[model samples]
Target: MTPSARDVSGKPQGVRGFSGALWHVATRAPAELFSALEELPPLVVQVLHNRGHAGVECIREFFNEPVLPHDPFLMRDMDKAVSRISQAVRDGERVCIYGDYDVDGISATAMLIETAILLGIDVCSYIPDRVDEGYGLNTEAVEKIVKDGVTLIITADCGTTADEEVALAADAGIDVIVTDHHHADAVPSRATAVLNPNSPDSDYPFTGLSGVGVAYKFVQALAEEYPEKLPYPETFLDLVALGTIADVVPLRDENRGFVIDGLEVLRQGHRAGLRAIGAVAQRPIETVTSSDIGFGIAPRLNAAGRIAHAQLALDLLREESASQAEQQANELDALNTERRQLTEDAVSVARQEVGDDPVVVSVSEKFAPGVVGLAASRLSEEFGVPAFVGTLIDGVVRGSARSPEGFHLAQFLGRHAELFETWGGHARAAGFTLQPVNLPKLRAALVEESRALEGDVFLGPQLHADGRVFPGTISFETFQYLDQLAPWGEGHDQPRLVVENVCVQTARLVGANHLLLTFREVAADIRAIWFQSGQHQADMNPGVRVDVAFRLDLNVYRGETRLQMVVDDVRPSAGERSLKE
Candidate 1:
């Protein structure tokens, strides 16, 4: 049978994975098209087409060709930002860079600070204490910066929506240059310059830049003024890639260019601190992939802010001494360990708070503000609903929300802005602040609004594969064809293939909750690992005909590299074993 056969319903089937999830396989490429596109792997074309990259030129660039970034000055107020920063440097004024605490914020802070130092300006950085100051510019942090005798304040990863804080700084005789990439309806008017591509007023070519991406653009604009003193933007792509991937921004358009070039810079191991962190994370920095940054390295950087002061992370990024970098890396690794435990404990408690409602709202003082977002993420994933988790701090509730694609958390929060002291984020994820008394109001409103828009409107725990494939085609040869399309993330997810009528040769439980199995589905020798699927072992035993969905990975064992299938889902075949068997 051809792999490209269209199913009766193209939408997610919903509630059918062996793990009690959903799987939505894309339509198959036609048989005639396989012969028409024999030059390229048929599966590759199918996946690209499913993602809407149809034309030849677009596919060629996404497949392998290099993508040059747009001019940095193309962003609105970029020229103004560069001019003001240049004047601050020439006048020998003391400047402070106010930034957030997440990986994107820290990386952007590092890049912008490094740029200011190269221009011979006296620069210091201020990363708000996560627990004390919350996400963005707080009145207390700005007051402290004003007291530090700073004449100019630069922001990275935040400040685009901070009208009050910017005005506070301006009232104290400080010119605030806001450099953020968060979603904003309008830019802060009091700031000397606002540089955010996502701003409604912006006419930049691309709007999906991470906080660090915007910071990189600002650095690029400044570099044009003194190209000799500052290394070209290539010097900081490592930071750009880290922030962009960790922030989970779309890996398309110009972002694709940053990661493609940045991955090469990361392999050079030029930055002492990042190299040290990579060593602690057990990732080979020399061959780091975009996925490595997202899963392994970025968490360690974020842990510094989650469990302790994110300033430690910012310091680690800029540390020049190998010994100091190693010490900080170890500290962050320990914090990440602690953070994992905290998130687990919090999720266990928050699980009880979820009811039969279409949405989830759980609040407690026991939840750490730093890790509430993680718990909210877990709850959202586990229950397939929008999750809101928050902790009570000083009579105020600071929380985070995560939703599926069908639900727009930002718009939902904006419609109920009266309940929040502050709220800003993308459609799927956001952070918010509100009075403790408004908790029930927000909770009731979420459920009311969500139920109104239910029924396949938002993204849920569904697995979307490239297309179906025949058992014979699942081999090392197919893996090699797909691996050429590297640097995948957010918009460009790793391609998944679904195979039907396959039999399991053997299956055994491994590592507490994982399934290690051998499949007789392909002639090539390949092992399958179904992570967290040990519970389904009985149904997937030897001789059981089943269908499986998986992505390909190159697994190295004892110095021998081999193709492996990282299973996403498994279910019984359409019918029982044939009588011929």
Candidate 2:
């Protein structure tokens, strides 16, 4: 899990530039063994082997549809959470589902609401305003729910760290069943029934369940108790995939099965709400992929949380009417665009202030609370360091921190817990708050922590090329074979193909910074383009021999399709095959 971009001035030998070659025969055996291995396709073997699948069985499982998940009752506290919620429903207690503002939170809320509805229970959702009310359950929101006669609260995606608020709700006679996936605290005495896979007391096999994953499990538990209330329990996997991918959970274990099977349901284009969202996002549901969920659908769903309230996304998910859902979806799309702009602007400003620090820490009183996480992630990307983006909210300084590969944000914050009012998050990303006066102490502590660590603060990027291949091996057939590995997400990435000592028959600039190249392989001639490669074009021109690292992709224009090599990196070759100028 190396950070992709960093200065590679004195990098160790053998590492390729994002697509560098590995496992060469010269470094292993003779040409006979190398040829034997090459016969198997290097790129395919490299990718498959990198992901711990060497045999045909593993490869088949990797590509094929995953198996069904075990029963929800397999979870530790599913029964307790479900029993409490069912009791509330039977007692006619007004229940409010409090959820987070992100896609995970929204989907979790929607899942709970739908499950409750199936049982003929009256359940409403409440998502805090990102700008005004901030994150998690708050006193104001609790008072309002209590006033509305809601005596039971089912929290989704949040409330793990809301110890005080959960106590307040209990004082007001509202019992809380927190069905969350966030990391558990040490004390762990907040909610009445805390059903989190990450909890220390839990024995769930896979702890990377998204917020929606926990919600689905809770609903499944209820479905078990009241079998007549719902049909088969696995029908809501489409929502599962949406939130799972949106939250960037590792697509492994139960999560892999959830998304792999869930994607089939999403692609069917049956759900009115999803259909409407697909329409607004302008993606054909029949052609939906994992990439579509992350790039097209999730952002719009998350937009409501960033700009206003996550309830909008929850409502859109639960909407029964096609027209109304479509309208809401369109609004979400607009809000997503606004969110993108805001995040980009914040990232630009934050990057300028990061300087050359190994650990980036910056604060902005004006940054939107919803977009800070994204901004911190982008800053981490640009600077190759863990980043913290903070904003002053209602006398409390709250922010999101995104960490690079080697850095553990949660552990780092935990070491400095005395400075924070509340702090909890995953290894890669986290959220926290402290007094505005404590900001300087936290920043100083982070710097000291990074300085005390040995060696590079950044993890060196390791480019695992799928396999080595001659330039002639790259063709339409090859591209199609590689594209078979679709629906790529976390735990699986697109394969990289490498070509060695190819003569740049011709090269020129196309659109602005794009570089188009006509290259000559041993027996094949092909045209390739590198997007945003003005500097590379100036460095290498016609007749220069070079090694090109790129990924295979299909390009379509006016319905005509052709295979293209998306250049990742190019370096001058020292071989004797240079074409004379």
Candidate 3:
């Protein structure tokens, strides 16, 4: 019984677990470059080349060498930012760290507060409530902080576009130093110093730093200027890494350095809260990798902000006592569980509401403001189109937007600026608030804009297979060589290989929704598993010939380890026949 390639709606199903994507092998690397990399396997070299690391030096730097941090002062207004922060520390003035309500913002807030405390500066932190205060600086929150006698406000992961809030702070005799990474039309004049790599006037070499990355640079400059006031800058890399990975920044250049070194710091478990969280997640803190941070640690940290006050997460990062850290970790884990359920419900509803329109917009009063972004992200990936999920309360609507590749979310939102009360974000993701009165106009505008895009703009998702490989070639040695590309994420992905013309010797459903199978090719027989792919079980009968896209993995059971293939996609062999029934 070969599986059907179409869904119940008679639409072609995506390969493997992808909702609606086509699977294809990536182009082979240039023969010259492939031959020059004598030390690496052809497949590995092709993967690197396909990802744009074609030159010899580029490959070496990406895999072997660490990217040295650029001069911190190269950022626009870096000098002014450093000088004002120094004066605040020297004069014993009240300082406040203003942040957003996400993992990036929480981590940045925690990092700066920790750095300031080490310097014996009078400092406090504030993260606006996602539902009440919205994003960035709000007038009420700013007034309250100023009224608390805060003389200086240093923003972390936010305030790039807070022109009015910065002006209000100035009117109250408070200075602001903005450290953000979001795209901005122009530097806000009211801020005493703005440290954004994306600013039009910025000459910073790397523009992909996360909000916490920017904060790390500020602390880097601080440590250089006043060595005695701050600890070695490397001590804070763990926080920088968490934010960097969670924010999905490109893992190249300076960002690569941050994650590589930061993972080392994180493995040391110097932060008690992180250690406790790792324990709850069943991940060994001493051997935590980038995937651990992305899947285990970050979700719990972000849960606090989504379901409750972000201060809980900030507290977890700053907690010093082992018992206290354990308590905080448990609370966050519970919140994360709740958040996951809410997100699942929202996605289910959003999927049903999706029409034939190129853009998906789901509005519901039941939607939680904090979880809308998660719902939007799921919709975008599942439908292969831009998505906007909003929660309507009273007459105001707060929404999060996610875009597929080839679309710039920030620019799209900019064109609709007249409809938003507040809006800003990067190329792929953004958030905004608007009145219900503009809903009709916003929908019409998006439809027209989506129609204006190229006809093939949303032609499903694409799965890039590094190259075809024989089942017999998947040995432990090959896996070890590929493991050198550690800390894989957004820009740097785990290698996916195509194993062509293999016969399924046995197939079964396991763990509810997982498809477990044994694939045989020539003299080799290998086990494979496809998670959440039980729906395809009918197609994967014994003796069926198929080509599978998979990632090489090691499975351990009964204290024994063996190689296995984690299936990404599966299709009937193009031109192959099985010898056995």
Top model number, lDDT: 1
TM-score of each: 0.94, 0.85, 0.93
RMSD of 3: 5.0
Which residue pairs in candidate 2 collide? 16-20, 42-466, 42-467, 43-466, 43-467
- Give the distance in Å from residue 66's predicted Cα in candidate 1 to where it truly belongs: 2.8
Who is ahead in TM-score, 2 or 3? Answer: 3
lDDT tens digits by residue: candidate 3, 213-278: 999999999898889877588999999999999999998889989999999999999999999999
Model 2: worst 10 consecutive residues (lDDT sum): 20-29
Better of 2 and 3 by lDDT: 3
Give a tens-digit lDDT track for model 1, residues 317-388. Answer: 899999999999999999999999999889999888767787888889999888999998888887778999
Clash pairs detected, candidate 1: 4-28, 405-459, 406-457, 406-458, 406-459
lDDT of prediction 2: 0.74
* Ranking of models by lDDT: 1, 3, 2
Model 3 ranges with Cα > 4 A deviation: 1-19, 522-526, 555-562, 575-581
The sequence of per-residue lDDT tens digits that candidate 2 reaches over residues 255-332 is 877887788988887677788888788665777778778878888888888887777888788788988988898898
